[model samples]
Target: MNHRRVGRREVLAGLAGGGVAALAGCLGVGGSDTSPLADHPVAEGLADQPTQGPAVGDATATVVAFEDPSCVRCAAFHRDTVPRLRSELVDPGTVSYVLRPYPVVFEWGEAATRALWATYERDAAAFWGLLDHYFTDQDAFSSGNVLDLTEAWLTAETSVDAAAVREAAAADGFPAPVQRNLDVGEAADVTGTPTVFLFRDGEYRTSASGSVSYEFVTSALEL
Candidate 1:
């Protein structure tokens, strides 16, 4: 329920301080050719686009969220807003929700994102669990131990194959879709975590940066 808003200046400073910007040019271009959402029910009726991420629900309205797994503000949005959003909007099929992994905060953010996609590829339920775990226990991980911790969590808490997930996460390059998510973020001029876009009837609508409320989303959707 707590919201910690991070500004663009602070995000840019973090990127510079962590040397993430330098690594941008070196981002890997090879990995699995399969779409992470290939088997996902939410992929139905969705366009085939490089910028597409995992989706849920079927509706005329769509909500695309770009988030960093290790971002506190993102965590706040997940914790404070997601449950209500699901109950009031997604579960009712009023809107479709998509999650774009934008790892802009921590050094291990990319690793976590890879693991997330791997989990979703393996099992949607486990993927949601891993997403909640990363946000809820962000402090319990670091660059050195993000993969290990994720492996341990998947092994202990989910039915997903931990070893395969680890292998995917430890792959040489970012997964194709994850890399496309980065490209999407760049094109959208995303400045920080939890940047969300709302659309109606497949047309672009408004967007919000940082933590947002259920009311804000509904208002954007004109629901």
Candidate 2:
């Protein structure tokens, strides 16, 4: 993993003056590079995060969901739109889904993603369940205490070895995969959380940012 010198201000953009407004609808903007908007190869490096991979189906198409765990819009999308997408698109073999992390929202964003990565390392099957827990309990505490809360969640709610998760989180290698996702997002010109990219017929087509309706998302998939 190449350690690029990303400024703190850039990472903290979502939490600045306009805050979410800074990120809300900035679709396909230059993200350190140009967007490969046409015939682009499927990101092989982004095949899947080894921790908790995406849900695959017989579908020949794919949708990459770049989201931050502490992002409010993302939680809303998961709560309201994701289920519909699953039943209408994923289950019907219309598209496969990739859940990649883009932890650039609030201050807790990156930390929560690192914690998620660590816990996922402990038990890959608990990925979705852990997401549900975090989204449902988003307001239980602020991002500052995420590690403590995550430790408790791992100990009580899942079969993961909580101590091992803690160890992994504190280790130097914890952020490598998360950084890979960020790199992939930047390469694809993703500039915001909850950005959905549509890939079909061996081409990267359109994308949308923010919490969107299921109909809007499904229509983009051409399902």
Best by TM-score: 2
Candidate 1 has a TM-score of 0.76
Model 2 poorest 10 in a row by lDDT: 29-38
List per-prediction Cα lDDT, in the order shown.
0.69, 0.65
Question: 1-223, model 2: which lDDT tens digit per residue?
Answer: 4533222356465556566564553333212223342334226455556322234433556777888777777888888888887777776777777788767666566666777787666676676777777778888746557778878888888888877666655454336767777677766666667877766654565677776668766565566
Instruction: Extract clashing residue pairs from model 1.
Output: none
> What overall lDDT, based on C-alpha atoms, would model 2 receive against the true structure?
0.65
Query: Tens-digit lDDT track for model 1 on 8-126?
Result: 35676856698443223221111222233424222333343212222433475777777888877788888988889888777777777778777777767768888998888878788
What TM-score does candidate 2 get on C-alpha atoms?
0.80
